[model samples]
Target: MALSTQYADEDSQNVLIAKLDNAKNVSNILKAIHFKESATVFASSMGLKVTVEDSKCVQANAFIQEGIFHEYAVQEDQVTFKINLTVLLECLTIFGSTSAPGVTTNLKMCYGGYGCPLQLVLEEDGVLTECSIKTLEPDEILDFNFCSENVINKIIMKSECLKEAFSELDMSSDILQFLMSPDPPYFRLSTFGDAGSTHSDFPKDSDMIESFSCTQTQTNRYKVSLLKPSVKALGLSTRVSIRTDNRGFLSIQYMIKNEDGQICFVEYYCAPDEDVSDPYS
Candidate 1:
């Protein structure tokens, strides 16, 4: 590709792979679709600034020491961010005008020539609580500095709800909550033993992606077998995602429950490639 022709960041492609890998569950097929879309959206949002491999993503942890487990001194959960959304919004406003690639636009900016990639900040009691930016959106400084922490927590409501499902092996109870939402993409997830998928009104044959039980081979290691992989590619038809083949890398955290009935978490560290694509998706 020519330099003047412009290219999207290589990391965007990787994130797409990550999304596809996470998209395996039969319940929240849309989340995989959403993850895949984030890459395209990131590309289109950055426009000329976002060239092939221009951007890098970091999943920094909010660490706490062995002696810092006290209630008042608990390590504040933080996902450190260093972002460049200016060029990003420009690309997104052009391509993401429709929701095909999971473009999230502000209602206010929609009429005002579409804003930029937004930085949604939530600060309460002198602590920086949350900073969420729409993956592909116009440049909009939606600085919602909330006075209360409750409102900011709502942003990650899905992560919490999904934890409920992940904590238990059976998903029958959790599946009953949000399957029939009249929304375009209702995202949900399952871990290890469950299957998931997405549904779209436009696609007549759209259905749920099935998941299955997986056994842990070792700490933080798992394997599941399937004939056809559940997710998409890292680049445009260049590579595919696999379960054991690729080391999973997540921008977010994975919720897990232990045998002791307590909540635990895992972050995607890495993945192999499409050749190792696992049916677990």
Candidate 2:
């Protein structure tokens, strides 16, 4: 179902509308953050932001900017709602998750404000599928307060290199340690588990190291389980930015390029494992 070209019509209806040429672009991004059942969505003229969280300790966000959509509009300042991510994803890929040689799924999404179900109209090769998913009370998202100004260490690198490190991580380990210093062993990841201790390091001058900055030698341990989900984002990204604040909280941002060559971003914020005592403390 193609949306009306006139913004006045969309605004007068007091509804939010957005249309995308390809549904897979949205499906893929949501899949990366689909570890949870429910997601809180915020829609504005800027774009759509979908957030998933676990125990308020770990949070993941998928951002699909307005630039990626053929038409996007928000009637108010913002529209907020919660949805069953699993059901929404299924509806988005009803036509099929994979793309055929020349077939494309076009999607028209709409929301009629609070207490209204999210409506989706998907058409592919002249075939159409319509879905209306019930929306629930939006959960209160956690405020990480992880500002760049508070970041004590930061590393920018090619995702390919980190992808290898994450893939080979010792699953037996309950915690993964990140070591960043201004000296040798510039960056290191270590895991201690039933088998043994394993460490992977990246040199500051290595080609894979796009940029590295560390105010001081600092090491922090994070729950491996909390970080494992981030691999999904790492796999889809071309480059990644890793940062840790003075409190030792970890932030990993992935730069993903969509099928249309538009840049989208997915990020994960994880609280440091409290069981692992801070050596510096």
Candidate 3:
């Protein structure tokens, strides 16, 4: 499948997006219930990116369906990120916020592809963990409140050292504010820690590399060809509008027409230049 690039915000030449949950909500209308993971993964404009506190703080896996970047936070220093598990949420800009400003809104956010990147590393012994959306604050501190000891213990067991050191937190915390990060729970960083464990079900790959963090846009015209990555299983081809300013770097512009509808839109993005071949003359 050809790859398109996903940007962070919407502009004249940016990609488009669609909120996954909203689609399912409207799919059944009266049901108004959220769809399961895959539906959201495949259809989200701006995916509902979240962090998980795994007990095996040793590793994490990326969500194959949504194509988001989910993995361990392996820093260049070779030290694994440790966190205090509490409220784990991704700090992303809601692209088309003009519709429903403060609610738990949904839209189709444009993006590059599934396979994202890794965000952490273990120092000293230099170990790496993989799962979904891995990374944390080295100096972060957290506390569990209004919860049961069993819940805390369960979280602890599940998070392993993550709760103790990986401190799962939001993107705005003082600790997270300065840290680099990843979005999708499953992404393509290095093929090593990515294959994960046989005890787990994350897709395996032996050839992958880390790159710049990508972005998303809001649109309704994207087509899904593969659902094998990120919590957002969305796969956008090199369709839609794109142009480069004479430079080798490529830029894509996604135009979304809502017609008479206020929510529907056009989304698009540019994929890695190296990933795609020259267009047919």
Candidate 4:
């Protein structure tokens, strides 16, 4: 079916309709948060927010703003649903996962109210493919109550520097420690494994650091397994913002620029490993 004809008939019934000239843009962002099979999606006038969680301790959010879409319409104030991330990524990359120099895949996505499957239309060159994927009822999402006002330490740095450190992280370590202080060792990442304790420090005056703000000395630990998935996002981002709240909650925000040079954001929230020593000590 023609893309226009398909939407023309369902326009009135569809609660959400979005069109993107390059489907790879969305696919690439979604792939960064594909740690979980199922993801809850919340759509609003602002655009789409897809949330993927692991063990209720870590949550990843991918924000694709309305401006990214060539055409975007949301009849309701907000629409929420759960979908299979694996299936959605596959459908978005049906033409091919890799980008071809002259070829582009256009995507049209529609959701018809509640209890309706998400309809996807992909067109590349003269070929067209359609897919309907089942949607599930959304579960209660966790609220970390993390706010900027409660942030004790925050650092914005180039992702390339952190990417190398993350890629070399010792998997044998159960917990990854973060020490941010106004004193010496301004920013540090530590891991204690079978080999021994290893630390990577970034000087506050380093060229890679875009911004650095540390209220006091704060040391917190987070599970390596939970944070490992975020490497995908870090690998694609140009800059990353790392923050830790008074409660020791960890927030990592990645500023990703898509193929069209548009900025998008992916965020990860994680609770501190409480079994460790006092963070303020």
Candidate achieving the largest TM-score: 4
Q: Which stretches of candidate 1 lie over 4 Å from their true place?
A: 1-62, 65-155, 168-183, 190-248, 253-268, 272-281
lDDT per residue for candidate 4 within 1-281, as digits (tens), equals 99579669887789999999999889999999999999999999999999999999999999999999999999999999999999999899888756568688999999998999999999998788999999999999999999989999999999999997875767578889999998888999988878877788999999999999999999899999999999999999999999999999999999999999999999999999988764323
- Scored against the true structure, residue 91 in model 1 reaches a CA lDDT of 31
Q: Indicate which candidate wins on lDDT.
A: 4
Quantify all predictions' global Cα lDDT against the true fold: 0.23, 0.89, 0.21, 0.93
The positional error of residue 18 in candidate 2, measured at the CA in angstroms, is 0.6
What lDDT tens digits, residue by residue, belong to model 2 across residues 1-281? 34655634654565688889899899999999999999999998889999999988899999999899998889889899999999999999997756578788999898889998998989998888889999999988999999989999999999999988876778568899999999989899999877777889999998999999988888888888888888888889999999999999999999999888899999999998878764423
Please provide, for model 1 over 85-105, each residue's C-alpha lDDT reduced to its tens digit, 9 standing for 90 to 100.
343233323223243342222
Query: What local lDDT score does residue 245 receive in model 3, on the 0 to 100 scale?
Result: 21
Query: Once model 3 is optimally superposed onto the true structure by TM-score, how far is the C-alpha of residue 186 displaced, in angstroms?
Result: 40
- Ordered by lDDT, highest first, the candidates read 4, 2, 1, 3
Q: Which residues of candidate 3, in runs, are more than 4 Å off?
A: 1-240, 257-260, 263-267, 271-281
Candidate 1: residue 156 lDDT (0-100): 24
Q: Which residue runs of candidate 2 sit more than 4 Å off their true CA positions?
A: 1-14, 277-281
Between candidates 3 and 4, name the one with more favorable lDDT: 4
